[model samples]
Target: MRPQLRLLCDSSFRGPQRSRDVASILREVDELQAKEIVLVAQDLASYGKDRPDELGAGSIVDLVRQVSAKVPRTRLLYLYPSDLSDALIEAILDSGVPYFDLSLQHVSKPHLRRMRRWGDGERFLRRIADIRARAAQATFRSNFIVGYPGETEDDHDQLLSFVGEASLDWCGFFEYSPEEGTYALGLPDQVPVGLMHERIAELREMQDAITAAKRDELIDQTLEVLVDEPGIARSHHEAPQIDGIIRVPLTLPTGSFASVQIVDAQGPDLVAQGADSAS
Candidate 1:
């Protein structure tokens, strides 16, 4: 697996020279045969904070086009967020980028605030709705933290509720792992490991149900799958090289797209049925 080189420069209103600078850098990469490129927007507003209105969506579309035109074989991953307003998420989807990475950590609002992460579950849901509205065929993914300090049974249950509501195309469930230097580490009445593990199991179970429903929902939906190497067919939720894949019945042609249908769900992987293939 090749490491994805990400350009994190905040595109907020820095002006034309900035755009040119970015263009120049991309132009250099145009000459080199890079494996993959991911443009990550750390925050919503910051992604397009700089530049003129004309530079808004067109600029991103142009940038991605430039890269692809330069290196015809390069794959681009646009990491946007549903945490932003629906309009913004829609704009991102309308930018002609085929991939989007959203976020959702611990469906419980209280736990989210406690973690000092994005709040507004309703808005998050709305943004997801917007994504589906704009591009029903788009590939989407999100994350969730299982346990948090002071997270009660009610909170965990609330999170479970959200799992069903979100119907995330891809879901990542992580057990709360505390870091000593962080504020969560200093918070009182930390959840016990045993309890945390219990909660993690519960959350995973809920996520499994939600994921199954999502997979089932897409059973008849046509999806353009990027074929993988022999014995490896990855899910939409899995990050490249970081997640395991479903075993495909037949070897698949690398880098080619094949139409597939969701047939089964296995933890993080969605076993897809396509024209005999594996990646």
Candidate 2:
């Protein structure tokens, strides 16, 4: 029997800054025969902020390269800084990791400030464009919070418009939940729960269309999907469960790779036939 594992590397452990010995981890990964890796940096920019030898974006990029060279068969999924630079974007494109997730809570600049985020939606849109320019196959997903304190109709409009423009392949939205001892808990004009539900529905509706359209674009394109099960496959562009799975009609051994031609888009899932065989 072979050992199976998923490497989840966090930027912070017991503190806001901690340096991970990536080489050792990769060596272990090689020994374990893991096929996928997920890195949770929380805030990539601020990673290692407290320490003198901080693990920054460059470290992640280097890790990706090493993983590719050492375990070329493994695929990577990671959370990145919301505010991305061109160098960081290019490094990611070079790493051959197809998935990119950002924590874009709100679009309106005013709303973002309320959430303590720095950038405007326009900046984020530009970043998206940058990633798309470098890697057309890049899988983009993000998380958003709707119905925050002091949210107004215009703020929602901005967020919706941003979503329309961004056309993220997959997204998760939740009504803002007030947490104990959080700054948001005391903010004025807290959104009504009823309105929060309505907003969530509307955002989901808009995103559903965009996500469907994004999925439809992959038709006829051949992707080297990793067989996760007898009937399902996943490519670099598709993450497990959240981004949904690709349906491969033929039975294939799990943990194997097959070239699949996407033939159908059933909402978030894509139906695929082996590139070498009949559907």
Best by TM-score: 2
Q: Which ranges of candidate 1 are over 4 A from the true structure?
A: 1-21, 28-36, 40-98, 216-222, 230-239, 242-252, 259-279
Stretches off by above 4 angstroms in model 2 are 1-17, 44-46, 54-57, 73-83, 274-279
| Best lDDT among the predictions, by candidate number | 2
Q: Candidate 1 lDDT, tens digit per residue, 169-204? A: 556777778876667778876778898788778767
lDDT tens digits by residue: candidate 2, 83-179: 3556556655665556777778888999888888777889889888877887888888888898899999999999989999898988999899988
- Lowest lDDT 10-residue stretch of candidate 2: 1-10
RMSD of candidate 2 to the truth, in angstroms, is 3.4
